[model samples]
Target: MSTSSSSFPSSASSPPSSSSSSPSSVWLVAYMKLKFFTRIRRFLRSKAPHKRNRAASDHHAAEKPRIIDAVVDDDEEEKKDTDKSMVLQKSVKRLHFGTWEEKEMAAEQIQRLARDDVSAKKLIAELGVIPVLVSMVAADESGRRRAAIKALLELANGTYTNKALIVDAGLYTKLPKNIEEIDESTRQEFAELISSLCSLANTQSCPSSYEIISFLISILESKKSSIETKEVSLGALYKLSIVLENAGALISNGVVQTLLMLSLEKQLSEKALAILGHLVVTLMGKKAMEENQMVPERLIEIFTWEEKSKCQELSVYILMILAHQSSTQRAKMARAGIVPVLVKVSLLGSPLAQKRATKLLQWFKDERQAKMGPHSGPQTGRISIGSPCNPREAEEGKKMMKNLVKQSLYKNLEMITQRAASPSSSNLKSFAISTSSKSLPY
Candidate 1:
């Protein structure tokens, strides 16, 4: 009834045995345990290697996308998507037809898009939007014209290749014509658009400039044009001069007389002076000629007309412009009787006219310089206004100054004259015609 005390051996260190502790049996048991464990280890290792490789492959695949796809995605679809965003949404979405505010916002957005130096350019190319913008400029609404002008200004900046296109589109002619019937605000918007276009046209140095100039001149000649339109027209003429200084366009356009007439208008005198001053300096060779250009005669004729019209500012400005011309031109101008008119201008004009007359007298003095050459002969003095008097000769000076001041050319001339005769007259030495040969510094 006794049981044998047997214990199961631990796997870590025990040897396998078939019978009781026999060496062979122990060896065999150990070998069997070893073989079983080796088989199990091989099975686990095989499966482990496959799992480890699969995991590594998956991890590498995920990590590989981060590097390779980064550049490829950027170079492919994503790049195109970035460009497509710039394409102007040409279809009139619901926003285009929304409430007044919404419509305004839409127009503003389009303008902002067109005004953006980068986006406008891309959108213009992508959406073919120039026609749309021209239509906007032609719109009856002032807000629309303002927005369209901004857009067109951006589009037209430094782009001369489109000048013919713009003109051919009849944008300029139509805008000015329509501006006449519009409200004042709308007219101003049109003016702004014209000014911007002029700025662009002035900078264009190509041969085709004459065409634009011609169009502007036509607009200027429109007798039905409003004063605002005329202002824009004259401004455009000034810009046209910048383009045509050497192009011989202004002379051919016969604009000098138009400018001369404009100068005579009391209301338009300032603007006319601005245009003539630039023309005097820029279009010197193009002055009226007996053969090719008769600009000198045309200009002198304006003085004659001014003298008749009693426009002293006009006379002074005309004289100033003549004074800047060549010696021959000045002599012709003087011979045309511009000098006496200016001398009268200096004497009769108010302080403003007198100041300009002072400069005109200075130009006359330079004209005398050109006349003082050794080969020059003693020319007959200008006697149209009575005997010319010299400095320091009191009685004769009194007579001549009287003749000069008697014209009373300006609206404010009487005020200036009274101011000159006041007890404080000594402070007004500039108004005095001194008898010294150098009495007039000019």
Candidate 2:
């Protein structure tokens, strides 16, 4: 068996037979070698399919880029969400427990974050960062206060809940007691924050504290205040005036007088007039405005600005509100020569201005009718025996009284007629200079 096995292996499994001198054997060996090399080359060139790749066995094929991108996007979203949460936690911690400088740094970061993400504003407020920032607003260090105010401003932008939190924090009391003393940039930042928080006037129950309104009024009255700062302060006052309850505070602080002064400035007159309009709806505001020296005259001056239609409309609206139901205000307005301006505005103002001017004109007309009832009487010469006095003297008295009563009205009507034909009638100037305070009954 061993000998047969060895002989079989040598014949079948060993290298090609050494008896290759024969031509047939040599040809067979050459053909076998060529076929073996061909098989080896084919194995090297082709790819083998794995079970996982059986569905797309084509060479170099990969999954679509969109599919990979979608997976990457989901992973990134999760990572971003985690990062946001971590940042929020860190900010809250720093705001609560860190030193003043660290807290200011955190506030700056929160401002940047809040400016970018609306949802983050509410979340950060919920984390109670607002009160901390508000406290920091009163810091002795200007840098720290400014950083806190900037953060509060960003948080208050367009987010009602955040503003509510800020107000609840009593941000008004946090306002610098002496606004004029602060640097311009810091003061402007404070004014801007107040303005932003004041926008909740209509929505929030307690729109702004009295401190806030007074602070804003002080800023407005401050000679040191820049135009931009005053403008922002005016905006805050405007918001506070929206609520009738706030009118008393505004008036008590003499905001009416401040607004009147501002109304004289062409650049600031529009906002000043707008706030006055808001305040004019209340009785206290009306009285304050009526008593103001600049009331109708300042507003009357605003009427000449044909280029300032908005100012005209606001000025007229404020006048109408002031003139409504208050004969004293009407008397004042009449003395201020508001008639000729209203006449011009009624005819040649903006659509809104024209409407308001016409409505105001109607009020004047009604007032006239109320004071001077129908003058027409029986023309008949029939005189009762019971009547006393002479005919010639009576006739003279009748004509003289008629002339006196109709004189003021005639003068106004003449001006209106002349001004209607020509916007800048000389008669208006004459009437304004000549109209008697006692001749017209408001």
Candidate 3:
């Protein structure tokens, strides 16, 4: 070793250089290169699975050729859903009572109520609601069409103009064809509508009344109807009879035989009686009598029937009217057997019925025997009193006479009491008793 203090400089211990691209530059470049390698490793690890899956998918997609088909199917399904929504909207339009453009979405509940044929027609005549609903009913299904027609009849009740339009629409002809084709509920509605039209015609002015009668007669003659339908048909005939009676043309319009037929129905017996009562009154009333003479003998058939409660009831009511009319009518009534029926019903019927019956008997008895000469036998060939009266019949007649007198006395006392209690009350007792005495046949 040299004695000098200067030692050879070790390469590891050399002083650091201050140059720009020295060790620091080399270290920075090495760090950047390391980071790049780490990033590359991570990307390779992540992309391996995705690359394999992509390869498999592309292979399968090529093999099947169904990708376009799948896409088309999805699009078609979406379109079908849209179309279904539109069809539902249209169905609603057909059934609803309002306008379609109102974009009115009706609930299922509302559809049923709005579909009633009768109610629909009735609503059509209302101020703004009619035109829209009528259009719906007319253009809709056959069931709805029928309902609308039925409704029109109800709407026509007080309206003359609507009635004319309904006829012009040919509703009557259109309705009956289906009357034979529809269900019971529909048939009932159909018949009722026809009846209403017939009734409305009667209420119309002049010439239309006769036209209504023709329609009703046609319905009666049709073989397609049931007994019930026939009964209603006959009822319409009787209604026409009333209008004719008012017109003083009851007999002129072939009403007598029609009325007689109506009287024979077990179901319509009461209606028949009412018609007869009206006819009797109409004929006896000063206006009707001034125009016509001779009661239609068709009215006398009621006297000869197998006497049921209803028939007897009618017999009493008619007798009451005839008994109160002039002596000539009373004589005619006696021959009709109205007198004996009155006595029988008085003794055997319900209290109110018996009272009415006995009262008529008493009233009819008041007339002298001479006045009853005309009523002694049947005036019409249609009526035949098959058997003769015996001693028992005469005795029964006498007993009924006694009961009538007693009832008359009791009614008088009641009348006097009522008059004292209420001065406004009529002297019903005195009138009833006196009339009874005057009409007595003895």
Candidate 4:
């Protein structure tokens, strides 16, 4: 009612102020309004139906409880493993049942499992299958006995722990007894088991070295034993010879003579030679071989045999050891004509054989030079002791050589006689006497 005829302007219609009247200002205002409206529209558009639904679902999920099934899956997996272990355990337990069919089936399963080291260890450790296997070794049924022996062999082949388990289960004692009456096939398996057990060093489950050696010797000496039986026995002896104590036992049990005889057989010579080589590492073994008298001769003969390249190499090595032991042993080797064979081997043998042969040749050369004096030249051929010498010194040298030969011969005779007179030599007296007579100096 008090208006003086003036009107207020609305925003849409306002115009013509000094700043707003310019074209640039009008455009700026229009742009600002358009930009603000555009931003509002974009904000409304960004809250889409699908995006809102996803957010609502995520919020609902977070608000709700999560029931984890991971533990359930892990438990299921563990249960499966437990079930498998239980099955294995049940199968192993069946081995001890009194029924023949059950025992045989259990043994067959064990044989299959024993081939795997993991399964073998499980059978022995987790399942305690060794005692059952030992009992099966004593079973009167041949098939069960063989199956048990085979299973044990597989188990023993795995680890030292498995071998000790077998031993603790009385396999060592029971195996020897089983070997007594079993057929050749079963005997071979028993022998193999013994060999495998003995291969483990310092195992209490192994048969005593003496018992093992005696058993092997008897097998080797048995004409009724199959070649495979004797071979495995020889292999066991070879393994046993690695122990120093066993070396003494092997010799004391007359293993050397058996080995020496076996060394001549075409099929067994390599193993026999390898065993002999090991045995001679000990002082007692060397003495035993030397006392046997035929050992060196056989070795020399093997070295010269045309088809025995491996045996020849071993023989050369063993002879080198024997020669290095003493001058007398070297002289004995020389008397056996080993020196010439060594020279031949040096010239024509394999590289390894040639190397060993050269060393031995040099050793004999040094030995000869020492014996013949420093000025002595190498001998080209045999010299006659009766040949006259022109110079006095030459004559003295010849006489000295003759005396050395006679002394060597006498020394050899003395050794033979002494060996013959010993009680142990009673069995070998005729052989020693004949050897001495043949070696006598005319």
The model with the greatest TM-score is 2
Which candidate leads the pack in lDDT? 2
lDDT of each: 0.49, 0.73, 0.47, 0.65
Per-residue lDDT for 1-442 in model 4, tens only?
0111112112343332334477888766555444533432343233222433344445545433331343345456555444443444445545532266776777777676666436435434445568888878877888988888888787777578878877777765564532355577877887898888887645444645555667778778877789888988888888877666667678889988998998888799999989887777677777888788795788888877666778887787677667663788878888878866765666566555665666666666656656755434324345588876468657667866786775676455444333323232112111111222222111
TM-score of each: 0.43, 0.69, 0.43, 0.63
Over the full model, what C-alpha lDDT does candidate 1 score relative to the true structure? Answer: 0.49
Which residue ranges in model 1 land beyond 4 Å of their true spot? 1-127, 131-191, 201-208, 243-247, 282-286, 289-341, 344-442
Which 10-residue span in candidate 3 carries the lowest summed lDDT? 1-10
In the range 1-442, model 3's lDDT, one tens digit per residue, is 1211122222233222322477876565455434533443333333222333344456457655465565556556545433433333333333332334331233222233334334433333322223333443333355654545444545666555555556555554343332344454544445565566665545543234444444454444455656676677666655655563443454445544455565666676667666655565454332342223333243345444544555655555555555565666666667756655554444555444455555555555445423433332322233136666778666766766665665666556444333333223223222222333344321
Off by over 4 Å in 4: 1-90, 177-180, 202-208, 374-442
CA error at residue 195 for candidate 3, angstroms: 2.0
Instruction: Show model 2 residue runs off by greater than 4 Å.
Output: 1-64, 74-86, 203-207, 325-327, 362-442
Alpha carbon lDDT at 178, candidate 2: 81
* Residue-pair clashes per candidate: 14, 0, 14, 0
Q: Rank the candidates by TM-score, best first.
A: 2, 4, 3, 1
lDDT per residue as tens, model 1, 195-220: 65665554443333455556555555
TM-score of 3: 0.43
- Candidate 4, residue 331: the lDDT equals 80
Error of 2 at 162 (Å): 2.0
Candidate 2 on 83-112: residue-level lDDT in tens? Answer: 555465456656865677789889988998
TM-score of 1: 0.43
